[model samples]
Target: MRSDLQIQQDVQDELQWDAILKAAEIGVSVKNGIVTLSGTVDSYSKKIAAEEAVKRVKDVRAVAVDLAVVFPGTIDHKSDSSLASVALDALKWTSFVPEERIHLQVDNGNITLEGELEWQYQRDAAFNAVKNLQGVRSVINKLRIKPGPSAHIIKDNIWKALTRDANIEAKNIIVETRDRTIVLKGKVRSWSERSDVERAVWSTPGVLAVQDELTVSL
Candidate 1:
């Protein structure tokens, strides 16, 4: 196991390596295996990028993102109405997002997406559409997946998918289904693999939510 100080240094280095983030704008601290990122970034996308960078470092157990988005003075801030219009346009252009079924609200540059879609990927696509908008400070995704038929088969399908995935050791994982939600319990070799397992679970047709209880065996 890596020490807290080593994890902190690697996280900082990882943030510095990411091209989208200004490394100096983010502060890194590690306690045990948990990393806390604080400071301010110019865009919401960069804030997401910083957290992702920390996740990529070896031995990082979990991440707490406390970064704030503060746009530079030179960039003109858009009024809430204008930001809403721009976000609508962006959603309309995203092919994966079903804009007709989704409703959004923009308040002081923070965007909230609320509606229901058939798949988790569509909900994710809708969030991605507005997160990079120039004036967006944060995005809250309240979008939900419409429940699919035959909940009985969800667990089996997810297990098959997990077994087929090259990155996951399916034998080490247990898949449990409660209605439309998947509860994953097991151990994964790394943070990335844990994410991979969750992503696979979400891609299944009947899955509406995932409760990931998988621990990384560092």
Candidate 2:
């Protein structure tokens, strides 16, 4: 039997080993069963990959993920602006936008933007603008936002994405998004599909974070 601290270290080591093997390029540190991961990945999928890799290791009591989300770490105005543009495009395309109600600013790839929308859709649109873009560190969403059609629009979008995806069935799931925070509940075919639904929610505009309450049907 291992002490609590030793157990944590073992888990960290296991997680680190898996992360390295998975080529996620993360640094792992353990302190008394609390594991901290530090590194960057190109997308949210990779970020979660590192976490899931660690969870697969036995004897891990809990996890503390401090992984820095980054995309290639090359600083350039072009890259920053491109990321900003994509974020902005996501917002613009969403049904929740008041169009002229928004303004955006980017500094060395850290985005601080503002807008006004009729509902949560605008906020979700704003979130979608930056979700997986390269060179983003933090976002300060200063949208004078509201919640109405914005929320409904996101629901519609979720339904569409889930229905079209072979791994998911819309009827089995319920989605509630506010200020870009998605809460998913229902059943899915596999762990992979669960992950897929989470990813889809993250990719959508205006989502700040995701909370998945889905169970595996099989």
Candidate 3:
């Protein structure tokens, strides 16, 4: 049986992936608590978005991103190198991120990315660019998102809602809301909590939709 921390991490990471997919952004697979990200993104930001989405999960040991680039023919040295270049280009071109902050390295078809950006959007841009490369097999993202007020507010509201409910344990779950879309993460001991939490979020005034990533551990 997984511990509470492990369960929390798994749920959060799954929620992150769901956000990306719902936005028509990218696709990810989580197996054995390891995340594999894949899909084609228009910009590098989308790639980073997918990876960060995975990293936010509490129990994720690591992520293997296989997202591809939109333009493949222009930079042709090797699969990994091409993907790296695309990622770099996306970061360099984006007005939101400074060139000095983002770094890229490639080995064969596997690309490694490192950087610090002002927002999750910039970080995701870098990840998306490399994940979708033509021959790229995997990507490892070591990037961080800069903090903001919105993130804090979302966290607070989600926490308050979860803890207030008798059926939900605050420690076992995580919550995130984007533009009124409430996403619930964590493992529940019973199905009642699952249904109850979904209803709780849906009842919240600002929530337009609720994405439940809850798992039942029987």
C-alpha RMSD for every candidate? 1.0, 8.3, 12.1
Better of 2 and 3 by TM-score: 2
Which segments of model 3 are wrong by more than 4 Å? 1-83, 93-99, 147-185, 188-218
How far residue 51's Cα lies from its native spot in candidate 1, in Å, is: 0.5
Listed in order, each prediction's TM-score against the native is 0.97, 0.43, 0.39
Worst 10 residues of 3 by lDDT: 19-28
Model 2 poorest ten-residue lDDT run: 15-24
Writing each residue's lDDT as its tens digit, candidate 3 over 182-213 gives 67787876655665676665444444445787
Best-fitting candidate, scored by lDDT? 1
| Best of the two (1, 3) by lDDT | 1
* Winner on TM-score (1 vs 3): 1
Q: Which order, best to worst by TM-score?
A: 1, 2, 3
Output the number of the TM-score-best candidate: 1
